[model samples]
Target: MLRADPCATILSPRTSLKEALERLDALMNRLVEADQTGAGIDPLRVAGELGQIRQLLAEAPAVVRAKDGQKHFRCEACGTISHGDRQPERCPTCGGRKFFAADIEQPFVESGAG
Candidate 1:
């Protein structure tokens, strides 16, 4: 049986986590439906996929890394996130240099007017 590639479609940069999970949920439903109706779907494979999706849902947000292997940083003052070879010297939004240094939270969606 052919299954969707989670990494390519669901985890790809162009896809949002919320959207990916919804798509996976739809697939899981189909598998379960097949299982209940005796549609020749393997029960073990169905269980495995259910477990895998559950595990992924339980995991924390993945850390973003730079192309040069540096950890990403962000400004706590104005919530300005940065990704580069090195830490940014100043926040592009407010011109404030201080950053999270070690702890930063990058939101999936940015709020407030620019």
Candidate 2:
């Protein structure tokens, strides 16, 4: 069996971790179905595919790095949250930077409006 070309399976722009996992699941189902059908299951091929699927599952998250890398800014003075790259130069709530929490928890979904 010819090994899958790494270049052909690159998941930089077209695929994400979630999608990759879904694809892995689909491949697993196919392998199981093929075995049940007595379709001359090639253990070597099955093993190879399982390995490839595992790799895809492991690599899929790299596509969504930015989504998980978001940081939040919290105004310690008034407990206001700002989901931006950096804390505002001045806190709009208390008009001071004496207390700022850029490491506050960030929700995965983008909060459009306050």
Candidate 3:
């Protein structure tokens, strides 16, 4: 029998942007402290933190767009909708190269009414 990785469960796609940022901040602080004190931080731990930081940075854009209600695009090949100011070079879900605007709403106009 294999056991599930706890870190994977904790740091998932559903992890909020604020939480990710907080984690990144904590990691940076740890690195700074280690650097200043000349402490021997575990090489594996540093490597893991670096990987996590990279992952968080990569996902930050999409998270910000989702929270800000920015425009979204749909992948033509896989129909995956991604939120951003512009279409991603490749679809995050399916790695599709083609995309089009997903949400194109006309501005609401009010008629003169008493």
Candidate 4:
């Protein structure tokens, strides 16, 4: 019997962030159900789902920033971040040619509400 991929629905290119979040929520509900009912959910499958959730959360910010058009690039050799629509032919800091799209992290701001 072939096992269905747990992430297949959420990993699709056309899946929206909202849909992914809903799917993850459903998965979490399953985990909670198993815990409460003493169901025999496979440990390995649980671990794999958690791992995938972690990865998706980690990548979500970058994906959102890219979709918003605030594209960035990082130099593989020197860890320098450059902002632009395309990667620099050569990194300004290290003159490295290879570049990977990266996310520009926004600075934190305090609301001053005490």
Candidate 5:
């Protein structure tokens, strides 16, 4: 028996991300069913699926964005932070050459209520 393409129904005028997820889930089930039917799987289809999943994850929204304020460059040695567009040539505190762009920006906050 030929397996039906679950993705055939995924195409529409207003296909949302949620709909795509549902279609992908159905396709996975179909692929699993096809595997148990004693037929060799299509390598190209599997490769395409892997690529799709990678792209989906890459585009997914990050959960840590709420906590992380912004992105800034931080010094590796003295732990000094710089909000410039690029890392400084030398650290002001320790004068170190090593620097990295921190995924999270934690600027010093003063609490005046105390």
Candidate 6:
């Protein structure tokens, strides 16, 4: 059996920033507990995920606006995000229509709110 992709699960459009942050907190707790028990921590994977999560949090609203419910086109070849009712048949730069759509959930520190 193949394991599911963590990023795929995390990139759900229904995911919320608040919930993402909460899950990050839980991961941190798990890391700490694992450290306490000397079970070894996967620092590289954790660091990579942290970076991706940070970027997602930073681009959350834009991601939603760009490709949440629509078939917006993002050029994997040129890294351009375009919003529309359909995916373009080709990216102007690379003329490639193959691309992946993922709902990005960004994480950020909430300030000035109780």
How close is every model to the real structure, measured as TM-score? 0.32, 0.34, 0.40, 0.41, 0.41, 0.40
Each model's backbone clash number: 0, 1, 0, 0, 0, 3
Choose 2 or 5, whichever is better by TM-score.
5
What TM-score would you give candidate 5 relative to the actual structure?
A: 0.41
Taken over the whole model, the C-alpha lDDT of each candidate is: 0.57, 0.54, 0.63, 0.63, 0.58, 0.58
- Judging by lDDT against the true structure, name the best candidate: 4
What are the runs in model 6 whose C-alpha is more than 4 Å off? 1-14, 60-114
The CA root-mean-square deviation of candidate 4, after full C-alpha superposition on the true structure, stands at 13.2
In model 2, what is the error at residue 40, expressed in angstroms?
Answer: 1.8
- Against the true structure, candidate 6 reaches a TM-score of 0.40
Clashing pairs in 3: none
- Model 6: clashing residue pairs? 56-106, 57-106, 57-107
Which residue pairs come into collision in candidate 1? none
Candidate 4: where are CA atoms >4 Å away?
1-10, 62-114
Give the per-residue lDDT of model 5 (tens digit) for 1-114.
565666444244344444445666777787787789775567677666656655664454332222435445556655566655567789877688887775433345354667
lDDT of 6 by residue, 1-114 (tens): 453323333444455554556556666776777789786656776776577667656655545433345644556554556566777777766677875554344434455678
Instruction: State the lDDT of candidate 4 residue by residue for 29-85, as single tens digits.
Output: 777877998965777776766676666645554422555576788666655677777
> What digit string (tens of lDDT, one per residue) describes model 1 on residues 1-114?
775533233243344344446657676677676679776665565566556565654453445454456666666555456666677888787787876643334535353659
**Per-residue lDDT of candidate 2, residues 1-114 (tens digit):** 454332234344355444555555666676676679775556765566567666665543221223656555655555455566666777776676754454524336453877
RMSD of 6: 12.3
